[model samples]
Target: MSIESGMIRWKNRVALVTGASVGIGEAICTSLVSHGMTVIGCARSKDKIDMLSNDLSKKGLSGRLIAYKCDVSNDKNIDDMFEWIAKNHGGVDVMVNNAGFSCKDTLLEITGDKMRDMLNVNVVGLVLCTSKAVKSMLTRGVDDGHIFNLNSMSGHRLTGILNFYAATKFAVTALTEGFRRELVENSKIRITAISPGLVETEFLARAFEDKDMAQSVFARCESVIKPQDIADILLFSLSSPPNIQIHDVLVRPCGEKI
Candidate 1:
């Protein structure tokens, strides 16, 4: 590779990706390692994390793959995960807050339990991870840090179904913008949000046990997006030059409409 092109590779940078046990988060972790970045993957599933760590070790392509079992909803676990990373990896330069949950429910018909779970996982999880990550960022004395939150297409112009999920994602987008402004003013932290249309992963399986409703959401779009597609975009956001800060990214397969 030419020097110009090689300079763009994230071979030495350190990054933390949450919700990396499966789906887009896993794809992002895999791609980051391939590009030479030291990727720290966090997920609540110990089994999946162990499998990924071992799998990547066999590939011999992984530079530094540290998989940690973390429950983002828990305060102690979140702090411990960040503390471990800081002790071993010298804090992260980029953090991807991809930990979230999805379940279909109408806004009016949504149960108290469902709403609380959604808020705890999606909104609360983001805030908790960001708080912990910011601590490491401050301790490392990193003048510049980047954060990316996985918002959804629903966060933008919500003109379709998935009302319950839409509300949570809108919260994400709002929180991202709010944090972006605050971080920019108070610190050198940069924030970006990505809203993906439809992705083909086990996310649907885990999210929707109901075959009928899952199929309904699946039918809204034509072709399902591959995890790699979102992963590539994520890498781009993280690897972009200092002056070029990506505010937001909208990724969708063809035929996906409002």
Candidate 2:
């Protein structure tokens, strides 16, 4: 399919991306903006997103990037963010739930508070954002709106080191399908779950205290996916014709055993 030609329909439209300060989220924001779509990049730390916005603005692309401060773990923050979007720039046509992380603790050692925080961000936050985005599309009679959930390979299988995090992703897998089934009855809105393995990101360093060790783990891998790779996949999915609904996409680096 001609991704560029398909994206003509989305030119000047708005797309909201959570956890947009870095890694895959940041790459997605950049790709969307490059495709002539106004992108809202939201993160808990708005400074980085603001910096990115400035950089993109200087490029003078057809699209623009808006930096938004949002803590997806907090319901109030999420509600306020959506409200502001509605009031200022109309509702979102694309929703990307990419804000997710694993705690430093293993399942056996994780505290209740830490577990709750992970669930709030990974599961609850994603659900709430999807609901609001879909509602916005339906209220505005937007049949071609899309929703993307950033899942993981762990969602489809078990990983000993990240058991708890994998559980959350499994929830995402089910949610993506559930959303598609529910929305297909009333609208043509599409939902896609992107499951990726071993992307070069801060996720591992953050998950483990030792940054060097994280780097070493990636070094051992034959290949590691880049953030831009995932961004490209998302663009391809988004650029599909309205008649085509690209569902679940499971991607892994070449030679990745698991």
Candidate 3:
């Protein structure tokens, strides 16, 4: 009903965001800090994590954001990351499974390696990480928590250029919804997916390699989005009343071509 200053008193909440080294994941970390929430930020790059930790300190957001180097693609690392979480900052109350990637390939260009790697990282990795987070929650006696999956419009519609990526995201959507239904029966855990259209971020920039091309992609996009936009949604989802659950949310830029 009423929201203020992004609910800047996430006082008692703990959030874990995977792939938080940059882009949408990084935005989620910073957004949560602004909301007065402490977060566990993970990525494979130690340098990136250190950078984020320092940034948090400089922003006067110290002690609220901790960084961990985690390679979600590995089951062992997944266990280690959550184990550290459980042993350290208490069990997470919210988990944001945003660690994902897409290779430069289409149906025609797809190779066994490309397709397999993409699926392994994007889909398999997500399931493993989310499972570990939930495990900690169960042990902590947290009857309820939140899970947010970063999905894409491709998950809902066909886009030839993104065939493999779409398949992985589609799987994520299904996984989230399926778990949401089951979790509602007992635990207070709520799982939801948010599909964001072409966003202006390093992800696209790195994918295109050329600034102009990346800019063009976002320019003609039905509506260019931003990482902060998705971050806002994450905050909103976590801030919703405990009994209320948002099943699936899709956001795109206006007038953008899909």
Best by lDDT: 2
Select the stronger candidate by TM-score from 1 and 2. Answer: 2
lDDT of 1 at 77: 87
TM-score of each: 0.89, 0.98, 0.92
What is the alpha-carbon lDDT for the whole of candidate 3? 0.80
lDDT, candidate 3, at 221:
64
Ranking by lDDT: 2, 3, 1
Model 1 CA deviation exceeding 4 Å by range: 1-9, 211-221
Q: After superposition, how far is residue 195 of candidate 2 from its true place, in Å?
A: 0.5
Query: Relative to the true structure, how large is the alpha-carbon lDDT of every model?
Result: 0.79, 0.94, 0.80
For candidate 2, lDDT tens digit of each residue in 8-77? 9999999999999999999999999999999999999999999999999999888999999999999999
Cα deviation of 14, candidate 2, in Å: 0.5
Candidate 3 to truth, TM = 0.92
